[model samples]
Target chain A: MSENRPLILVTNDDGINAPGIRALIEVMNTLGDVMVVAPDSPQSGMGHAITINDTLYCNSINVIKDAPHKEYSCSGTPVDCVKIAVNEILKRKPDLCVSGINHGSNSSINVIYSGTMSAAVEAGTQGIPSIGFSLLDYSLEADFGPSKKFVKAIAQQTLKNGLPKGVVLNVNIPKLNASEINGIKICRQANAHWEEKFDKRTNPVGRDYYWLSGEFVNDDEGEDTDEWALRNGYVSVVPVQFDLTAYRAMDELNSWELK
Target chain B: MSENRPLILVTNDDGINAPGIRALIEVMNTLGDVMVVAPDSPQSGMGHAITINDTLYCNSINVIKDAPHKEYSCSGTPVDCVKIAVNEILKRKPDLCVSGINHGSNSSINVIYSGTMSAAVEAGTQGIPSIGFSLLDYSLEADFGPSKKFVKAIAQQTLKNGLPKGVVLNVNIPKLNASEINGIKICRQANAHWEEKFDKRTNPVGRDYYWLSGEFVNDDEGEDTDEWALRNGYVSVVPVQFDLTAYRAMDELNSWELK
Candidate 1:
């Protein structure tokens, strides 16, 4: 942005060795000087967690041999990697920060619980223009072909236009081939909730234990929603902000007699 | 609205045995039928994380002496506690959910990383009227004396006047004596972030590690903000929403040439 090749910081929640971050690194390399500091293990549902209770471990890795990028693997949540990168790893604030080309969908209400989006949100809070990309596919071998070009274009657009202050992008690509995919659509987060069903089981000692499993239930059918766009074969791009303030509810709260 | 006493869910990020939750439990007991399912250990900065990768362990615990409320100690994040309560523990969806009389401030940017607020946000997603309470003091012996009446009044008001759809409250009390404290002021989350200063340390074996630490820096001077209210000796109440979508920026994103 300052007439220099933009310093782009890359990271993700699916761990450093995931194919998704590999794809992201390649795309980021084509865009600018790239530096990646990502988690060492998969952290899918980590949300906006930071490593405050425990010590964090970070080590340099040679993931892409001879590639013109510096990458490190940190034993922390996605949000932690971003903090470590900006505060301890990077020489200066990055011009842009991109998180994920995630292994699964992070659309709808999933954004709140997504470590992918949380990394981007963390960067946005620190004045970096940021975006988190996800594909509807959830497998290790999922194809990132269709999403690469779109990811490049979005990153380029963000670099050129700059994002709105306090906003980051949540881009979800539908699980479809390049040709079958309709372009990208700017949309809002569709309202949704997980119908949680804990799979109860007994340990070897006969104590009860549980595994959390949930079915995503979409409650909003609005056409202008991330869920709708992805379902209709479009890569949905939702601008997300970290300011959780519900300004509209302030008046009603103020009306209460608190004296 | 129902003839039966309102079924109230109480939870916090500070573990099941924290004095803050104990204070909250005492207040909620006066207004409704309370059930508490909280983390067995402190989960202060856990955010909205869930227990997905690991098996969850939840066991009923007698937290208070001859207390009428049923309590469970959960080995999970605060968000997990809410899910377990709603989907497994509680007989039905709760009428109201209240999280924390947290030991520290969750005002401004801290809300994004707050386990207390995350518990409340999880309940709001379930269509339950919810509120999170925090005190400006961060101490094991922090006085919740001044906050009890306010906490009761707010929770009572939430039971009486259901919160706006998709919204929950983030209430923070100033650390002052009840007589010295000003009243409550409904406000918005102040624009701010932790100016991160990672206290990097080397382990006994000479490996690099970090303990996350930071100072709360207030960048917003708005009089109608949580920081301002807290600074002025008033308990700040900020209405929080889980919808990460930045609706105002949708128009700008739409103009991007993503094709």
Candidate 2:
């Protein structure tokens, strides 16, 4: 709504210091007045966790040298960063809120466990136009050059056209180089799951512990799915909503006739 | 799918020691071979979170004295409990997975931040029939007696006729006694949100910190909502799904025509 460049709030689950967020900050610097309020530590799978039982600490930081954007580091989850940014930090609600450029994919069922997408969803819940971006690669030094144009295009388009109510974009970029990329595809979330294979190990003190490991399984054969789009070398954009109600099944449930 | 007693996986975000899960366990014991796998500590706002970067420990515990049900206390989030229960503990997939009888409500927008509902959603993702139950009361000593019959009936119905794929239930019982309570109503999640007020305070060391405090704001006046049903003394049952995809927005997004 700004006559000047729109005020964009930038954040991520990989912490303010992560290269993923830095790449995002670089992109937003060209777009608008950016203010980043992100977690001080990596909060990869924190989901929609807030600092209820504990206290939150948000401190101003310089994530990039002579950065155009002002930044703050928060001592909470990605969702907490968005809450504190909206309620306490910013003087006004931001024109747009974009989370991530995350180190790993938040496609398909990963969106549920994603701290990145949760931040975006939190922003959407607060009635802000928001988007979450993630790369298929988990490497810290993954190539982000190919994603720059697409990311900016998406953000620019969102700013111009505006997002629908109760909806946010979950954009996942493939790891392919710029030349190998096949452009963006707006798609639905695939019916996929993580086949959890917990690595059970015994501690030196005789205590047994397990580390969560998993293999991504895309069971949905639909060509219109985010999984299919990502697999086919395109950046996948799936519009996500926070309303969990399964309206399609409500009639069936009503048929139960519970007393 | 068992020809004998159906296998039920019972879990809660309030940890294994909480009274809510105990009430849930008691109800499930009468209906099936109940196996309780819950968090070792309270994980109220851990929505869809799993322990990825850290280690998890799941230990057998006896919460109820002379209990018929088998229970395991997991050192992870509520979603982790479900993952561990399904993968590491149970020999076969559970017939039904029930999470919570939560001390507090998981109604409307609260479901997005709820660890209890996250467990149920996780089960739903794995193609299991799941339900998350909560009471409007937040007290540890709140009477769960009023909820027992309704909870049993719903669970019985779910067992008799399985939930559709990717669908789960979010059931919130009102605070009234059993006789005072009206019948269950299948409803939609109300468009509601918390009006967050962060209590900013200086720590003993003089640095500032904030505690998240909020009041539930129900702006939606729709009578068909869960909020309406709960406020009118009826138990609200909302069939929830894990498909976050906003299918309605796909066409508009496809029009973007990114280069």
Candidate 3:
């Protein structure tokens, strides 16, 4: 409720204690009053999932000692974290909501299965300026040192100039150092898909189980795509929308012979 | 994998035992060689979540005895079911994929948080012609008799015409008797969202917990929307696409002063 500073909400699919979120919190502290409410445990790949069938437990955490911003960890998905923050935790609507600084890339078709982008999109649906950040590295100890400046820059600019209505940004940084990065490029989501290759195993009880895994195939040869931007050593920023309607295909569907 | 019979894949957000999917199964059996792979437990509101962090158990279940179709129940989200079906179970890529005759509506804003539509979208990502169907009624005992004809009609059309690349269908039927209902309407997703209303409860141990619930709010008055079509007693079929890129906002985002 500070008059001088904007109220910024921070969350991520990675748990509150994750290094990626810690890096994000460090950047947001300079911008405004930050309220961090993220999952108590890692919630990667939980795309837009809410805790409807179960109870949620959210409590204050002392992740960083004497941190100016308050942080709460919840036992729910990323979308659940955002909903609870907006509905019950925050005194008023946040000026901006930022998610991720994810441990891995969420470019192209990965967005659909991304918990990071889903958190940002959920905030966007509530009419808040939002963005999701990710690094091409999927390691727990991924270098977030270089990402700080770009993250701060984008967040600062978003706070200064609001995002377009019904749109949120999906930003992906390359796995290179600050000097090697070609800088940010506003790009389109490349047409791609995950070629699923499940790892099947037999348990002690002689029953089979599967661990879901995949190979991301980016067939989109567009020079102006998120895949291209990231592969070419630039941070890719694709403005994402929640409206799923295929407006261009409505006319073709109308021609179907249905009664 | 007979050439004479089109290979159809059926799945739903509701468990394989639900009457809604049972209704869908009855209809699909008459169409092609149907392979039913769905969650063993109810997975409503699970969105596009995939089971990445945990092991998934999928087993053959005899839900409908000698029903002339194979049914495998998986302990995973809707998207996980689709992924497993395509990668581990199916002999070949499905000719078409159909999800749900969900016990509740997935119209308008519900599509984002809907496991039903997510299943269809997951299939669509792999180039399968897919559709998610739902009835306005949420009750477990809700009658699906009226929905059968329309479901068959739409599925048949999809198998014959095939969907546009990267597009799937989200169809919601009004909870009206067959005779009292109007015909199908090709529409766009209505702009709407859920107004969150969390119910806070104290546990016996004096710890606070919250149950996530919301009121569906649809303010979009456009007649070409799925909400409007459903309100007027028609089956609303919105051609939904997996591409979340906000093409219109790319230019505006490019204008941002972020380096």
Best prediction by TM-score: 3
Candidate-wise lDDT, in order: 0.92, 0.92, 0.93
Query: Candidate 2: where are CA atoms >4 Å away?
Result: A1-3, B1-3
Worst 10 residues of 3 chain B by lDDT: B60-69
Global Cα lDDT for candidate 2: 0.92
After superposition, candidate 1 runs with Cα above 4 Å error: A1-3, B1-3
| Model 3 lDDT per residue over B119-229, tens place | 999999999999999999999999999999999999999999999999999999999999988999999999999899999999999999999989988879899999999
Worst-scoring 10-residue span by lDDT in model 1 chain A: A1-10
DockQ of the candidate models in sequence: 0.85, 0.84, 0.87
TM-score of each: 0.98, 0.98, 0.99
Question: What TM-score number comes out for model 3?
Answer: 0.99
In what order do the candidates fall by lDDT, top score first?
Answer: 3, 1, 2
How much DockQ does model 1 earn? 0.85
Question: Cα lDDT for residue A144, model 3?
Answer: 99
Per-residue C-alpha lDDT of model 2 across residues A16-63, encoded as one tens digit per residue: 888888888899989999999999999999999888899999899875
Off by over 4 Å in 3: none
